[model samples]
Target chain A: MTCPEELDPVRLLTPRAREVLAAARVVLERDGWDTLTMRSLADELGIAAPSLYKHFASKDALRTQLIALALKEFGEGVRPVSGVAALVRAYRDVAAAHPQLYRLATSGSLDRDALPPGLEDWSGSPFLEATGDPHRAQALWAAAHGMVILELDGRFPTGSAPEATWDELVTHFG
Target chain B: MTCPEELDPVRLLTPRAREVLAAARVVLERDGWDTLTMRSLADELGIAAPSLYKHFASKDALRTQLIALALKEFGEGVRPVSGVAALVRAYRDVAAAHPQLYRLATSGSLDRDALPPGLEDWSGSPFLEATGDPHRAQALWAAAHGMVILELDGRFPTGSAPEATWDELVTHFG
Candidate 1:
């Protein structure tokens, strides 16, 4: 099987593929993972359903690509921050900025085994290094994931002290 | 609205209600909250779809009842234990025994705003009292909820060694 070199770091996508991805992100942000059907995406992009098939084989393929894009965006958002405290702050900032996308990324929307060919390896290194221990890294991921969910669900107190829980979480990491 | 008289607290349900709840739990366990249609639950119980409507007004009504059942079962599971350490142990035991049910309870499966008529006072009181401070109660709930999700997702360590992370959380309450 030939690896999709179109996804390589040095390779650039054609303009139409870029447009498809941009439209997919809008669908993801607006309707979330459950409603992001290929037909819906085609409708959003003002293109025929068959056109999406040219860019992505199926809904699962489209999801894999969307997840890859979300992870890359997440990495970019958090890259400048250093240390656990800063990392936690960065994570919270990124999550708050893209609440729906973050929820979709963490909500088991994409099957781990079906990740875009090389994308899993590319994504793991930064997260693995952040927590030092693999077990702690996984726990931290859950904690952060839960935090985003709680925030979105309005479980956090709404008042003057908006960032209190987030500040406490950062302190725990430190 | 007339309150249903309290039954045998130990049993927590009429025999028929228990049968309905049991079928509901099976559906929830096999399929997560999103797919728990009223028709599906009736089909699972070998009853007509309309019969489920006799028991539960809607899917939300069924979910609210299921959560109430889960909370009562959870309260009973942890009642025999005392203090923070024992409470933490009981938390893990209940989570392990009924992983899906536990998820349904802690995750926002039940609409907090539209909780069943008398359930507002019944939910989480036992666990909260075990923690004493209201602030710490919220944190303890978050930690326990986060821990159980991680455990159910197979992120927790496999051995029987007590989790230091959990111990630290309990320490905050003690």
Candidate 2:
């Protein structure tokens, strides 16, 4: 194992930081991002608002950290396969399972430049490799994203199975 | 022109209601959905909060009206032709023009059952007819939505053209 001093600072967060993050997730999942303010998070953790600042510089900082954690959890659940279909399935499952969090990660106001290391690259590169062409992977990812948005929005037509559409997308584009 | 009494009640809204809606759009576009509130809207209009209530029953009511207005405007912009490409282009243009409004119309807290007459049907039926199959249309719509979200969120990689990605989606799926 690497020496403790050599550990990445972010990876070396204090236990209180981890607790703050966990409480933030609960607030996010329960009330959505708009409601997950620093004060609310602190209230949920039974602590003073300023105490959260020690763990997170600001609410936006807390949000970035939460998204990174969510992405990490999502990455872990993704199947260990290079096929395009599996990747789409993994992405869809995560989005469907946590629709609000998915929106926060995908479309929230978090600054992309400030995302934790490996997160943006993870989102960008793997799909490029999966389809063996950047354009194809890009189109495929967009289509998959559209389906998830539709599903979450309840806009999918009655009796239309999204899975079949996913299969068709894979067959036609993958 | 139809008689004033023959028009739908919503269509028969007072000029002040229209003004309220216009101001609400400006607020929504400028400050985003989270910042829009009855008090803020009244402040924008230089009116009392109670007077604004004469036009809208609650915040959710105002949101529903805003979404309905957006959908109507979107419907008017759709090309006369029924091809999938025209439909997607129309949707994309509207989304790009007003990203926040599109998000509100597509995914906000407006109750589907409570949508103004013809709004839900308007969004649901046309795409189905364009693609010539419900399932295909559903998938295509999702892909288009995904592309729009990615574009709005700057998720596309540097040097990649979203329009080209859109063209690729239409060619493969249309």
Please state the interface RMSD for every predicted structure, separated by commas: 3.9, 2.0
Instruction: TM-score for candidate 1, please give it.
Output: 0.75
- Listed per model in order, the count of residue pairs whose N, CA or C atoms clash below 3 Å is 0, 1
Off by over 4 Å in 1: A1-18, A48-51, A116-131, A156-162, B1-18, B34-37, B80-84, B117-122, B125-132, B154-174
| Each prediction's DockQ against the real complex | 0.25, 0.56
Quality of model 1 by C-alpha lDDT: 0.63
Residue B41, candidate 1: alpha-carbon lDDT: 83
Across residues B1-174, which tens digit of lDDT does each residue of candidate 1 receive? Answer: 122335122144457767888898999888877677777888998888888766666777777677777766776676665676787778788878887787777665346554444443444555567767444445455556666665665433352223665565454445
List ranges where model 2 is wrong by over 4 Å.
A1-12, A37-40, A157-161, B1-9, B159-161
Model 1 clash number: 0
Residue B154, candidate 1: Cα error in Å is 5.0
TM-score of chain B of each: 0.73, 0.83
